[model samples]
Target: MGRILLPALTLICLIAARYLADQVGINGLPAPVGEWIDPLRLSEAAIWLCMAWVAKRAIEVALRRGRNGSDEERIPSIAFDFLGVLLFLVAIIAIAGLVFDQPVSGLLATSGILTGVVAFAVRDLIADIFTGIALAIERPIRIGDWIQFDEGTPQRTGRVVEMNWRAVRMVTVQGRTIVFPNNALSRRDFVNLSLPERHFRTVKRIVVDFSVPAERAADIIMSAIRATPGVVPSQKPLVLIDELVERGTVFSFHFWVPDYPKMFMIERQVVENVLHFLDQAGYAPSYPKLEADIAWQSVSEIDASFDLPDLLHRVPLFSKLSEEERLNLAHQSKEVQARAGQALVAEGDAGESLFVVLAGLAAVHKSVEGKLCRIGQVEPGQVFGEMSFLTGEPRSATVIAEIDSVFVEVERGAMQAIVRENPEIIDQMGEIQASRMNAQEIGDSTDGTRELDDPGFAEKLVKRIRLTFGQPG
Candidate 1:
């Protein structure tokens, strides 16, 4: 009803304007300076056309904002309507001037000279406008695109927020808005991170001491990445031995993420998971260690004794297990030893076991085209080989001992036996594993690390203990 009334009101205004214009005549005498400039020889039909043109333009603007139509359909229609308005006004004025015996040729010639001067003065502005038009047509960078400009020392990376006739605006990761001239952008080297696809590859580097073999570090990093959220397994990750630094070997793991907007969050998760895994595996990132001048004490003078049982009790996985359950699991878990430079597990090898590190450090590596590369290291208390154990598949990568290490090996049969003996334990384990696996499928790699600390698991374990003793769950 509003739309119909609007067009009706526009038609009435057009009729009034045209009626007044026809009364005044096309060659009317000039009025005083303060008087309004009245149209000469305006007709009802002409006035209606103008009113209809304006209404059409307003409707087009509303539709554009709604974003209901395709660019191909909407843009050209708007352009045509705009040009029609321009032509209508120009033709009306020229025709009126000619009907009144006024010289429009001279006016047009003067206007042309003025337009040329203005164009010359605003050459750069014109260039920017054309560039903007080109950008819109080519769509090198679209609205909401994540882009990085490689112009200066530190490249500017941001999400494109808006594009104007002369400039483009982007919001940086730090929440700063940057405006770049369209012409400048056209000439600059910029990468549309969200172009081609929304996915991007992010690389993380972990440097371990040279004493920790490179091959082992590579495997650890690769395994961590594969298990980490946001990493796409279809695009196999790469572990490159970047360089040999003075203190240690520097290695980088390059993995692909499907969403560029979530890159920062995913990278942080990967780093945290890698660090936690390395810490548990007894491997720490390499840094220069300070030497004390008075550190020549004999081996017999140093006390190395510590309570292993007390330390093990602090671990969350074992800490909550009942005494009998813990002892049972311990009995089923056999100690395996590996010396430095020894391969603990090889890539593409069959295994039906999982290892929990008890002491010492090991490196994880992956073989790419027959070349062994270091990814990262593992530390005590960390579990490895679970991938194959759970999936009943071959190992994707290899684990090698970086130092003389002791690890608790729980064979598949033993684990199955424990699960069968305690069905409740299996239920809890399944819940934890299922939740982590679901998160991985959705690219949330840190789900395993964070979700594993479920308080409900502890409560369930307590309830299970009570139930075994014929008490309430």
Candidate 2:
């Protein structure tokens, strides 16, 4: 606003001066002064030029507002600037024909040779500017969009940050800013990952041993990719045998993400989870052929450990259980797969079993002021429904699967038997439960609600547990 203030004020002053000169008959005042100035009509031309500048600034301001209205919408400033310059040229031509009574065609024709010489000398710069104008009009990509240039040995992907008459600037994943010449970009084909929509499918390839069945490998990898945190829940992930290689069978894992900028991070997470699941399934990647005899034990104790017992070990409430007890509990437990958006438990619903997340994400929502408000997220290795499991109470919050998730359900019978065998375990479990309650209390404090504190909450919880299980206090 400040930048345009001077130009606007100058225009107003020029108009007022011209009006006063006309009223006072200043055009006929003196011989030489009046004759020279009146014939050129310089005063009127100045007013026209000033008016054009003010109009251009106003148009640019409107363009800025339109660009800021949305994350995906963008309008290049250079396009408006070029239009403003063209406006100035038009105003100059109009003033020459109307005010000075000169022929506009002659003026333009006389400068044709000079324009040709300048164009020839700076042809590359002119091409860039014109290409930029074309791109600005077509708008294949916008600021903050992820785009790929498919010209090199390996394609380059980057987030566009700036665009102008000369170049388009973007920053790559490795944090390097590349200034792409507008003319070059215009000549080549590029892919806009953010166009059509932000969400798009991405794929990663893995090699598995030929000993592993193709269908089984695909199932395992698909599960792993679907359970990844950033995988779009609305789109189902896919896995297929892409090719057969000398080393093994090549499998392609396809998943969707909300945007392209985080593709690398999500791909890494998917790879890590896939490898973990593959290791747990006792299927490692194929090894290179060698002359020596290779002793490969495909089935190991680690593969056996991925059952309910392993998930129990991850929970702090069951961390103290002996391996034998864990195996016993595991025998009585069941592994369940939950589809994305499924509600596992609702607030105030009776549930005698607690679930431990083995993979994928879940969200905890509670009824607050008659509205379901998300309180927290439950990730892999975390536990939920324990409060209801321990005291035989109604569920305190609703747990919904944020993605395709796996969980191990520990039933009441198994828990009661383990607690009876290890009576002292009641106090340990109660303490952990109390700490969790206290954390919830702190979390709710911001909203003026308070829950039980840690001091006597554990003892009270232990008493409730004994009563719920029909055990002596």
Candidate 3:
């Protein structure tokens, strides 16, 4: 397609350019020595520039395809640039010879000193061009390579988007563009995160009270890392005891991720989970340094202090679980607080975490007659969003906090781990869900209300929940 289309456009531009030149009476055959400058040539140069661009694009597309068939298409883009330049010079010479009866080569020979002066003026630009060529040949970093440099301080990191004749363009993780001169990169040492695999391990160091057992802290980190969705399972997360600082014991947790762009997001999840786990496991960081660490954390990652295991015990489904099991659930749980009228889970919004009300009350509301009507009150120890969270379905009703509320949010990840450890809970969970659905306190007369007690319906719902949450039989 490119072969047929671009060349035809180039031909059209060539024709139009000649017709315009003829209309303006292109003559006055100025010799190279006679006209040190020619204003008339501006019209001709513009047309040739258009031709070169189109011709370069077409050649690039065609040659890339042709090369891919028989050989490794590692052909550098500079080759295409050279090819287009050669064609442009040929075209300019032919046009100049026809108009002024002197070729560009002859004109250049007469203007040797002028050409050398121009070359010296653009020496920096020429150096960049040559450096870019060498970089393309060396192939240290190709397009799409994630790299980090300026190791001294205020590091620059980004993915290489493109390499032009003079500079390398990179788009940073913080959504900023950085164009570095080729000579700059040629002299500096950069860490290519793309080599071998995109997966790279990042370390997060935390200082905890010295009283806390290192083994326990390491276990908590390992659990969080393994349960994290974006973490690469092939690379096991590691924990190292670096040193005991003035504050507390320093522990470094290393995690591997394949996608560099989502580093912050995945790290946020892991860090938040680690904090929760630490809090639940009766482990606390040294307050002086911990305060600073907490302040640096994103709003979404921060949580008010709460006893996660105790909250999990309040949930009827997890109430019967053993102390160890409850603690594990707590490690995987998120503590969420809601003010009055704040929706815990909204109708038609997809959910994975079951909100177990820990304090205050929430009103269960659903659309009735095109208006949200209060159905029932969810008090302490009661659960909402179980159906949607368990089944990976949209919330059937909106549960808004009637007053200030605290909730023990149990996500699918925690549920999966729970299932993996205790397979027998699947049946119990299904029965509890069915019983809750059939209870009359919730005023909805919809499918979730009426049909849940049906044995087949319960079985199907349980199966779906199991599958969606990655619960193995």
TM-score, every prediction: 0.56, 0.65, 0.51
What would the per-residue lDDT of candidate 1 be over residues 1-473, giving only the tens digit for each residue? Answer: 35446656776777776666667764444677324543443443355455556656566567666765553223433233444566667655655474445587777787898999999999998888778777766778777778887642223888777777768888887788889988999998988888787787888887876544455466556556665667776787787999866656788889898866677787888788667656555467988757423333333332122223333343433454566666666566676877768988787789877677655566777776899877766565656665455445577667887655666776766555555566565445445444544444211111234344565654554454334334345
Task: State each model's CA lDDT, in order.
Answer: 0.63, 0.77, 0.70
Off by over 4 Å in 2: 1-6, 28-40, 62-71, 150-156, 208-223, 244-249, 276-473
Question: Which candidate comes out best when scored by lDDT?
Answer: 2
Compose the digit string of candidate 2's lDDT tens values, residues 396-425.
788898766667788888878888888887
Error of 1 at 128 (Å): 2.1
| Candidate 2, RMSD to the unseen true structure | 6.5
Sort by lDDT, best first: what order? 2, 3, 1
Give candidate 1 regions above 4 Å deviation. 1-106, 150-155, 230-235, 258-261, 289-354, 357-473
Q: Compose the digit string of candidate 3's lDDT tens values, residues 1-473.
A: 74658666766867787787789987535798436755356556656566676677777777777767332234555666767778888767766775456767768798899989989999888788888888777777777888888861223889888787878888887778889888877888988888767788888988876555555466556655655689988887788999977676798999998867777789999888777656544456765643433223332333334456776765656766788888888787776877767887778888777876554456788888889987776555557777666777778888887655566788877777777877767777776666666664441223345565566877776787678767763
Clash number by candidate, in order: 19, 0, 0
In candidate 1, position 217 carries an lDDT of 61
1 against 2, candidate with superior TM-score: 2
